[model samples]
Target: MEINIPKGGITITKLLLRICSILIIIALVTSVDGSKGNSASPEESITILFTHDLHDNFLPFEVRRNQGKYTVGGYARLYSAIKEQREKDPDAVLVDAGDFAMGTLFQTIYASDSPGLRMMGQMGYDATTLGNHEFDFRARGLAASLRAAKDSGDAIPKIVATNTIFPTDDEGKIPANLQALKEAMDHYEVKDYLIVERKGIRIGILGLMGEEAASNAPMSGVTFDDAIESAKSTAATLKNDEDVDLVIALSHSGTSDEKSKSEDELIAQKVPDIDVIISGHSHTMLKEPILVGNTIIGSSGEYGEHLGVLNISLDVNKKWKVNEYKLIVIDDTLPLDPTTSETIEKYKQLIQEKYLRHFDMEFDEVLAYSPFDFTPFSEIGIELKEEPLGNLIGDSFIHTVRELEGNDYEPIAAAVMPYGNIRDSFGKGDITVSNVFNVNSLGIGPDEISGYPLLNIYLTGKELKTVAEVDASITPIMDEVQLYVAGLSYTLNTNRFIFNKVTDVRLQDFDGTKEEIDDHKLYRVVAGLYSAQMLPYVNEKSFGILSIVPKTKEGTPVTNFEDQIIYMNGNQEVKEWYAIANYLKSFDKIDGVPQIPVYYEQMKNRKVVEHNSNLFAVLKSPNRIIVTAYAILLAFVGIVVLIITLIVKRRRRKK
Candidate 1:
């Protein structure tokens, strides 16, 4: 099928073919020279503006820290900071670790728009990991959030999770929840690792959720691989196969008080090939970068209080090094990105139109006044010991439950707050309803309310002692379960034998009266619904070393705690924030306005700590749990001694 072509046409075709060959050769050379098509050196320096554990703090908050008041955090301010950095160095990237969702009213629309991700997309986050809170609405909810983010037609970040071990054919039936999550992860191109070429620098990025974080996500059906192993494998792939110049691990594993237990630190030490680890979940603020072998790790504190800025440069040998590390404090002093501010306001309007309007709540209505600061982050706060903040919250629960449940509610003996549920602090100055909500931002029961509803239950005084015991024994493992009580005081001897840490438990009265708790008496107690459900699992978590049994004031056993849920405010859920707000409003007006009492300025001694764990000291007020714990310890020691003795005897006989 040969067709004769004209002489001029053939010459034109030959010239075109030669031009095409020359263009292909030039493209190959340009690619090989690492020329961002400019024949420049491949050595590139990058600046990273990183944040973690944002937890939906869309607006700057006026917070009192270290006896000073300042406004901190907000996407508007962060966007401006990121913008400045990017303008300075075009190679700069904005990234986050995880938990960018599920903290504020904006989280209510997670299943639809996922305004958090959308706003991040608008702010230009290059990539982000999934924190436990991202799955707070469950797998289906996460899927919807991702779908909405994609549908918005916005330039969204490349999401990644390196350690998610998806179910396989050999793993049996995949649960519907996990299947949905897997599909979303796939659709969003969430890979084990990503190689991004930014300004001639190939950066390898991987995301990980640590065991502690996985523990927090009880509803997330996905299983995660070991952080250390997964990180090492992914980093190796990036280095050996992809030849990336930098390996970055976005870890939601959190920093630990002990280096031995810290997940990110451990990864850094074990996987020295990783250049940087932007850690989250622990809410740790490291002023200086932690150097573990060749890797450097840093974490911005929880919320958007600070932006982590890191500069990385390559040495002559092409090995990466952190040139500078700074935790840039986000405050009102920083310029607000107008575009981002508008984006935030758009979500606020969405909150008003979609959810808050129905509840008759405005985002910034002043609810009360605080003359002093109250933060769980303090040394004596709920996260550690019982501070005045804990006392006020506990008392509020008692008062709110009594008012809403009426006389039939059997008078709550005390209200308890798990430290995990207390999110933000009450800063000195005008306390708005939003501020109150921030302090108590956590949980949604089956009713789908904005906050966890207050629940009342009855427990024997003996069970109260068990609760104290659990606090002492299990708190080191699960700090979130540390209980802050109102109307109760306990002296803890931390050095005492395991499961036998509390030395004294007494009932505290409003006038500072102290009386021994009657173990046989049944007393009503109040707690958030989520904490109430978790109360029964203490024994299981402790491997049956501890136990708790919730009951009714009538001495009847509680089979289904949910069935006994009492709705307040004419069938409205008595939200925790409302209880706190109502309680704050009840305070005496100081300076012609209701203010937090001056009493919180000083320690209330709710938890008197005596480190005397001597045998005599521990035996002072031993309850049944402590007595049993001692017996078990002694028996185990005796058995070990006997086994050794028998082995020695057998060895002597053989000899």
Candidate 2:
């Protein structure tokens, strides 16, 4: 073999050695990438558990999903889920981004019992923020609720309201109601921010309220500093002064599909030191954590439907590295905590005695039996079309008002309901008092009760048409403002100009008769007190282009809304929720239980939408608003053309 050695054998041997060297290098590189290699184990692991927009769902509530009623949330299930998470990491930091109150019958005693707060305390929430709904009963109610929570001597979570402001009077003193709120805050030891140690990691948490949240709480009497500014200040202090390992923002600011409106995301982008953001208020369910720079934004959705779990570990680089993030669904599959269930039952009893008894009702009294499910509460305002639940509520309003007024009843030309006010929907099967209250469970009446009282307001037919226009135009931009009506119907042209979307406006009777609306004739309109109060806000929202001033029957401009609240049965305030119960009871009964009629199962053409791209159709009925808009556009174009011509002539002269 040595005598017959092949030519270039030495060169081949060198090439083989080089190839083997490259393979060994590649294997070494692969091994380094696959395993920890020289890097040390994570210094420490941190677990963060969070929930947002709990919304007083202390019991497992049924929600309509995929044409089925699925049980979701409840403190018992939530507590069990929390306990499970704790078992995995006992030192997990638990917190909530607020709106924890004002959704169910539990909120009926929010001021007196503080059921939401006390329950959160029981559930072991380390910290929580205040959402707009916390002030739904106004500043006085919030103050009272805080005092009640403090008085309960329960393990209440630390409340961190970073931007809450108490405005002062000309005498440099806070108003009595706001002063009381301040005192309550001081008593509760509510701070702008709080710090805690979790398994040797110092965590700083700050609460913030968005501008829209502040605006929603107009009657709160307490204002808020700018959310971004507040977050920046708090985050800087926590990082630079407190020297915390992690900074979490419990923000009621919320996230939106629209970037400009996404408050929490904006905060994360602006505040670099904030490591995590628990966003609330818009009830957004962010299935996956949003990573912005080094910050992580998480949302667990509304009504305690899910619990957010975020896990991270400190790497050798001394920076926190995300390990995993998930939203644990609080469904029926989760075991219920017996103690929490018993506590919830006790709260139910308290609600029955303190609130439900006044209405001559039990907490679970069946108001009606629904053979079919109405629109799910989550889907109520998603689209601009007429909602069956809205029609039911609207018709219920008219019926209750008529029955209450009796012989003194004036013809109600329309009963309008804002989508924002329609909180929940009627699930199929037995509808209870709690269900009805949840549907109409928004505001407190002038009587300092839980429900918003019905009120009668007058509007010109022109304003009624404007209301239709608002529903057609503004609703596309603001779903919460979408108007649902009974005793009125109209066709909206999608192609029409802004503030001129309604192609036809008419009055429709429940008997299916359509009548022409006299532009100057005053029409009697019935709405919730909160809805009535929001009427004038249309002018402001529309930038004064569209106007809707709710007037008195005598054609005087109404000032105080409480004065217009409708009363019945010898001073018994007519609540919007009671109207639904009464209407359901009035329906034909089968086997002694009122049945929701099939008539409500279908839309009664309360709103007819027309999709047209025809230019002629769009311009057919140009209102004063459209004409003014056209004139402004023409002027702008003319000015631009004149400037261009001037510039061209000057350049030619220079040439």
Top lDDT prediction, candidate number? 2
lDDT of each: 0.79, 0.88
TM-scores for all predictions: 0.84, 0.89
Query: Which structure among the candidates has the greatest TM-score?
Result: 2
Per-residue lDDT tens digits of candidate 2, residues 1-655?
2333376456556777899999999987654221221122265678899998888988888877666678898889999999999999999989999899988899999999999989989989899999999999988899899999999989899999999988999999998878888999999999999988775567889999998888888888988999888888888888777777788899998899999989888998998888889999888888888888888898888899899999988667655668989998899899989999999999999998888877788988888999988878777788779888989989999999898778988999999999988888887799999889888898998788799899989999899999999899999888889999998889988878888888888999997799999989999999999899889989999999999999999999899989999987667788999999889889888999999989989988889988898999889888889889899999999999999999999999999
Question: Which lDDT value does model 2 have at 210?
Answer: 90
Task: Provide backbone clash counts, one per model.
Answer: 0, 0
Q: lDDT tens string, model 1, 67-178?
A: 6667788889988778777888877877899999988778877777789888888888999999999988777778888888887888888887999776655658777657
Q: State the local distance difference test value for candidate 1.
A: 0.79
